[model samples]
Target chain A: EPEVTQTPSHQVTQMGQEVILRCVPISNHLYFYWYRQILGQKVEFLVSFYNNEISEKSEIFDDQFSVERPDGSNFTLKIRSTKLEDSAMYFCASTPDEKLFFGSGTQLSVL
Target chain B: GIQVEQSPPDLILQEGANSTLRCNFSDSVNNLQWFHQNPWGQLINLFYIPSGTKQNGRLSATTVATERYSLLYISSSQTTDSGVYFCAVASDSWGKLQFGAGTQVVVTP
Candidate 1:
């Protein structure tokens, strides 16, 4: 089965520094998404991308957060000036249909 | 946004036991899925059942869309099955999934 791949299994960054999370979605999948889970909390959707544009985003996905598919295969999420609260496990997901497939996740810690 | 409620926030079972986890949603949904988050925090898709029943190995899931609820049953549980089980639903076509708080399960030997 094809799966989404995320790089930097663990990332440590200083508060107010910039960090980019990378994901390589399944080749043929069209819809891509990013979700996050703070330790002990439920997973929350951040943004959804389709056809090179954002379809929908949550309030948590504010000005500081941005997503881009720079190339056809790589989907990246950039956080400018990270805050301590940004520490969490970020998951990248993709789907050809309604059923989504998720990557292992990238654990980000902001100090 | 839809309201999602999961019962018995946590559960513990001895290996070889059976258990059921419940998920209730407030509105109609187009997609419903169950996922298991392992110790490493990887979300593994277990099922995608918006309605009716489906089974895989010792695991099964039934979604009663009319009742707005879903149930996941694990039979002959093993320590490997220990993890946090989550139920998520998408109310719209190709929409974001709203997740439940999840039921944390611990299977002991």
Candidate 2:
């Protein structure tokens, strides 16, 4: 099965430093998404991307956050100046149709 | 925005037992899916039943889109089936999927 691959299974950063999470979605998939889950909380939608642009974003995705399909395969989420509350398990997903295929996720920890 | 409600926040079952999990949404949905998040936090896609029924091994799912509900049935449960089951929906305005709090299940031998 084709899978979405996220780099750096775990990351730790200082509260004020910048952090970028990278993902390589399935080759044939048309839609890509980023979601997060705070410890013990529900998974929350962050943003969706298609046609090399952002299709939609949630309130949690504010000015500090940005997503890019920098290359044909690499989709990335950059957080300018991370905050303690930004710590969570971030998931990258892709879909050829309506069914979603999720990655193992990257655990972001801000000190 | 649509509200998703999953029944019985917690469930426990013994091996060889069968169980059913329910997901109810506040509005009509074009897309609905059920995911199993293991203790390690990996979200496994179990089923994408927007409507009708589909069976995969010991698991099966049915979605009555008109009734705004979906049910996941697990037969002959095992320890490997222990995890948190989440139901999510994709609404019109937001193409991004929104997830419910999830139902935690603990299957023991």
Candidate 2 residue B29 Cα shift, in angstroms, is 0.3
Query: What does the lDDT read for residue A54 in candidate 1?
Result: 100
Runs in model 2 lying further than 4 Å from the true structure:
B92-94
DockQ of 2: 0.70
Task: Flag clash pairs in model 1.
Answer: none
Q: Could you tell me the TM-score of candidate 2? A: 0.98
Highest TM-score: which candidate? Answer: 1
Native A-B interface contacts kept, per candidate: 0.76, 0.81
Q: What is the lDDT of residue A9 in candidate 2?
A: 98
Which structure among the candidates has the greatest DockQ? 1
Determine which window of 10 residues in candidate 2 chain A has minimal summed lDDT: A49-58
